[model samples]
Target: MIYKTDMKRWLDLVLSIIGLLLFLPIILIIMILIKLDSQGPVYFKQRRIGKNKKEFYILKFRTMRIDTPHDIPTNLLLNPDKYITRVGRFLRKSSLDEFPQIINILKGEMSIVGPRPALWNQYDLLEERDKYGANEVTPGLTGWAQINGRDELPIDVKAKLDGEYVKNISFAFDFKVFFFTIAKVLTSNGVKEGRSHSKSL
Candidate 1:
């Protein structure tokens, strides 16, 4: 597991630095557009469960209105689109909102590929991930589950896919996830506004 223990961190650091440098202009433009399209902070920080079930703040461009309910998953929100700002919709569809997570990767709080971090209040997801030991690894900006189904998948299925990633983690697997993720983002596939199910603890 040298890759997990040693190489992964270094890779995340180097790639994140490169990604930030490459995306700087786009990031600044998004920041300005977010500010102009909404009356809230340019960035949104949410507490999420990271490796070993520890808590860390995950950063994204603020894609929702200031009045949106805090700490609740968009899937659980009623008429979630109502809370999304004009520019936010494009950011979500383009996956540009996730660009700030390079900072988390830089901070060693996240990886470039792994299981997506669960919201701090997503108890169902947290517990489900425990069965697969998915919580043992660093959470990611884009992951296996993300490329597979993203918000469209149910919690159990998503956790299982995450577990699959944990069981088969490697450079090869990560490369596949990373490549497919770009495809998913390009097509804006599997993105959903809200789920019909009620939240369960």
Candidate 2:
């Protein structure tokens, strides 16, 4: 069992620390912008289901306004823009908002690459993840499903992809997914402007 995930956990730790250091300036700027663009804390914390179906708080830069929607996923909201802040859109598109989750990874609540954790209340997706055995592994910053179709993929499809990742977990596979994630972020591919399109990081 450890063969599948221990290496990944170490990698997640080292890389997340290094990445946080490298992106310190960028993170600071985003923090300032998020504060200036809206009224809220710099970081948004919400409960998510992690490895072994444990509930843990996932961290991200506050993208939505403070007035409403505490724990709801961005995609679930009918009027996502109503809650989304101005700077949030760009951050989401760039995938920079996810920088805060590096903290989660460092805390051992997440990995650098694995199935993205489901929201605490996403009962159906949680059930699907459990069925696929995806819940046995720590959720990650990016994963196989994210690079494949992202928001375009259905829950069942995403679960299957996560299952594939769990079965094939390795350095090479993680490297590939990491590269593809970067490419997608740069190109803004699979990023949704509306809440109905897909989930956010």
Candidate 3:
């Protein structure tokens, strides 16, 4: 099947390039900060499911210590607040840790707006993704889920919103989310527990 790339893809390319340009300094600074805070690689790379069920390595700034626990959320029901470092908390609250994902966007593995990708280890959530059409589009750095309820919403609900976004994606909708994302970041509104700061899903 010849899948049509949405017009939003071009927008994604443009915005991601711009994001990289604007945030390059921020990225560098975060790298230095992370190295100073912990004795691990500055960037954390992990496998994530993308469009058509393809796998891609998602990039994030390392926020935890070298000895940080690796249990996927489902496997361990403990609170993430305990494992996160002091620097990690600030990086997460400011969302500076997510800046590395711009590289993923530049590489065509992600979008500036779409469903947030689920980790490959999230088998249960990944299996349910099909029900919400989550695999139909490239995962994003931010999306309806992040703006609406963020970490507060359940995975199933987030998937449903993702599906809705897939069905209704457009240039206008993308702009809406893009601007809303800026507002949310500025106000730090609706960022909930157990999700935003790497909580167990």
Candidate 4:
């Protein structure tokens, strides 16, 4: 565990710094579009659990319209498109909306490869995650579940994949996920579930 701790911290610092240097301009463009598309803040910050069960605010580009109902599930299940802005849908599809999370990674709140963070109402899923060993590492920007099925997969399936990633964490696997992530975003595969944001999991 100490190895993972030290390794992840070092990688997080190096990758985040590099990510920021490479993606800052993209972040700025997204921010400008977000402001043009909605009345809310350019960046959306949400609380997510991190390593050691600590909480940190995850930053993302604003992809939803202002006054979007709070009832919307953050997980993207049921009605993914209902709350998304005109530009937001494209951003989500391209996975560009998540570029800002590099900031989260830089801040030590996330990793480049790990389980996607769970939301507050996702307590039941969190319980399942804990049982499956998904909570063993810091959450990430992209991971096995994401590269495999993304928002299309059920919580149980994603949880299992997440746990698998934890048990088998390795640089090779991380590289695979990273490149696969690029492929997923390019094809726009599994960006949403059927007609909804995600299938409620």
Candidate 5:
């Protein structure tokens, strides 16, 4: 509980600072590529539900066309690929698009490891997370549910995995999720282009 109540925020601040410093060059490169591949801004900001169900804007490298629908889950969007820029596809696949969220972590709006934030419009997912107290902790750049299934898991199942993380929160567990997330990103595992069904979003 000490990890969750006290040390986690400090850890997030230190790690996010280190990560941003380390990835500065790559971040610049990604920004350039995004500009070349799309006509919009270099970053995309979306409102997301964070700790204690508060809302915050989560930042990521812009990966979609400027005209794409706002506040909609990609899986629920019609012809999602049609709206994704070329570099966006690679960013999504490689999970590099998430690098900008180090800013969020640094800002204390998120953590390095916790439940992934739900989109503001993802009412069902938010309600489900509330059931298990998953919304009590700060959301993360990558999380237990993210490593377990990423975009492929159903809403309830994903929330359950997140709850499991809340139950077992610790440094060891966080490291495990972080390490496996790297492997998942490398293999592009548990990533799906879109879902066939909606979850009441």
Candidate 6:
């Protein structure tokens, strides 16, 4: 039998391409806005761990000033607001910052649904996820942890949710996640409300 995991790979490719094309105009607009709103790259890339503990650069829209400290998790930052650009704040709030990860999906570094990638330096989250076997599958644009509580969830809780997602992988489950993501994005709901944890990729 063709496993759903294989099916999910093809699904990621198809949907990511389609989504890229559909959002191209909006992406361009956002790029221009970011450029005008800040003095830095429109896109940001950071090293993140993918399946099997492989490291890959995750792409995102740059939502922070050029001098923002890199490698530290947002929630650990002492003063996140000092680095967030005006446009970056909006992108983070709308979850539009995540759109650039379509490139990661196309590169097979990620899926549309799975555990969200942890930064390469995020050993705490990385270790927790590894313990739960969440790092065995491709990371995602959004996942069970994202839908459940996002940044509000503790590291261990996030890993548990990710593990649960892996166990429940299916076309139906993915569809369910897709719809919930749309709803969250539209309502700007479930996202952490503080800029303290909204720095960059």
**Candidate 2 wrongly placed segments (more than 4 Å):** 1-5, 199-201
> Where does the lowest 10-residue lDDT sum fall in candidate 4?
192-201
Q: Put down candidate 1 lDDT per residue, 1-201, tens digits, no spaces.
A: 998789989999998998899989999999999988879899999999999999999999999899999998887787877898899988887888889999899989999998999889889999999999999999998899988878778889999999999999889999999999999888877877756632211
Give candidate 5 regions above 4 Å deviation: 196-201
lDDT of 4 by residue, 1-201 (tens): 654768767877888888788888877777888888778888877777776667777777777776665534645335546677888877777778787788788777788888988765577668778976787688899889988888777778888888899888877778889899889778877765335444222
Worst 10 residues of 1 by lDDT: 192-201
CA RMSD, predictions in order: 2.6, 1.6, 3.0, 2.5, 2.4, 1.9
Cα deviation of 44, candidate 6, in Å = 0.6
Range of the 10 consecutive residues with the lowest summed lDDT in candidate 3: 192-201
Positional deviation of residue 29's Cα in model 4 after best superposition, in angstroms: 1.8
- Residue pairs in collision within model 3: none
Best by lDDT: 1
TM-score of each: 0.95, 0.94, 0.87, 0.87, 0.94, 0.92
lDDT score, residue 5, model 5? 90
- Tens digit per residue, CA lDDT, model 2, 86-130: 898788877888999988999999888899998888888888888
Candidate 4 residues lying further than 4 Å off, grouped into runs, are 1-3, 74-82, 193-201
Per-residue lDDT tens digits for candidate 3, residues 73-137, read 52242566766667888877777778888889989999988888888877776777799778878
Point out the higher-scoring one by TM-score: 2 or 6: 2
lDDT of every predicted structure (CA atoms): 0.88, 0.84, 0.76, 0.76, 0.86, 0.83
Candidate 4, clashing residue pairs? 76-198, 77-198, 77-200, 80-197
- What does candidate 5's lDDT look like per residue over 2-51, in tens digits? 88898989988988888889999999999999998879899999999999
